[model samples]
Target: MKKLFIAALLFVGMVSFAQDAAQPVKQQRERLTPEQRNEKHLKKLTTELNLDTNQQAQVAKLLADRSAKAQKHMEMRKARKDSSIKPTAEEKAALKKEIMDEKTATEAQMKSILNAEQYKKWTAMRDENKEKMKDKMKERKNKL
Candidate 1:
């Protein structure tokens, strides 16, 4: 009985170590190229929306563009972080305005691409996701 227990523990430990060794650790926000990001978003949207091929192609282009723009913005933010100087009030306001304008433009493009029902469903999903993010942030804040 003692030998059996010891062997089982050894097997469990070995399996656990093998699993750990099989996984590659990555950075918290390890960078992916825009094309890679676009592919991921395309797969997600297709699964969610049941997009036709034409719609998928159009959405892919939009997603690629959005991903590139996002990467650019991320680079800018990183640059700002690395610098000692904080952005001016005007700069902050400008950044916010830019983000809002892009969001509106993207929505318009999406509406044009999607059928009426899909657009409505997409909006609902986006809002739900926003709410979930807010809740997550609140929970994180409470934890701190």
Candidate 2:
């Protein structure tokens, strides 16, 4: 009787451990890198806005440009992270302004590719995705 009881307890414990292990795997699968997020947003926009081939090509170019700029900014920031070397407020502001300008340019180019109605839908989709990304990041931070 004791042997059977022990076996049952062990089986239950194993099942619970398996379930705990599975949860994080599921969560990790849902997590997106910056590139993945961009691709997903583009895909959603394309589907919802019914982009033509020309629009799709233009959007792709915009995405590539944005990604390159973002990567460069990240690299620059990483290079500036030495404890003894800090950016001045002016320098930081300048960098931020540059990034914002690049973003505005990209958005303008995208707008040119899309019709007014499509642009509106695209903007709405982009806003919704920004919120979703914020929520996902919050969830990841909570997990950490």
Candidate 3:
């Protein structure tokens, strides 16, 4: 009876460890970095849109530039959060305007990179991706 109890405990512990190990691997795969996402988007565009060399180069550069700007904006927001200081209403409005303006500029750049037909397709793909991401996030929240 004593030997059997020890064996059962060992088995339980091993099963617990195996379960814990698998979770982190699954979570890591789900958590994508901004750079990784940008690269994936570029690859998708190339494959789906059948971009030529010049178009690919232009799109790649546009994506990289937009990604860098977005990272900078995110860092600024993090810094603001870490400071434990709240902005005034006017300041908040100004910041919102700035972000919107930046988005407008980025959209213009995308327009310059893509022709009319490609832009329409690109916009559709972007909307579909946003919906897919929303669904994924909802599922993740329910799991938590």
Encode model 1's per-residue lDDT on 1-144: one tens digit a residue: 112233344455445556675565533455566587678878988888889999999999888777677767767866897986799999999988988888898999999999998898889988997787567556645643
Q: Rank the candidates by TM-score, best first.
A: 1, 3, 2
Clashes of each: 0, 0, 0
- Model 2 / residue 77 / CA error / Å: 1.1
lDDT of 2 at 46: 83
Candidate 3 has an lDDT of: 0.71
Model 2 weakest lDDT span, ten residues long: 1-10
- Mind giving the per-residue lDDT tens digits that candidate 2 earns over 1-144? 112233344455446556675554322245566678668867876899998888887887777667676667656666787555799999988977886787688778878999999989878977886787567556645654
Segments of candidate 1 deviating more than 4 angstroms:
1-33
The TM-score values for the models, in the order shown, are 0.74, 0.66, 0.68
Where is the poorest 10-residue window by lDDT in model 1? Answer: 1-10
Error of 1 at 76 (Å): 1.2
Off by over 4 Å in 2: 1-27, 30-41, 82-84, 133-144
Better of 2 and 3 by TM-score: 3
Error of 3 at 122 (Å): 0.2
lDDT of 2 at 108: 88
Better of 2 and 3 by lDDT: 3
Poorest lDDT segment (10 consecutive residues) of candidate 3: 1-10
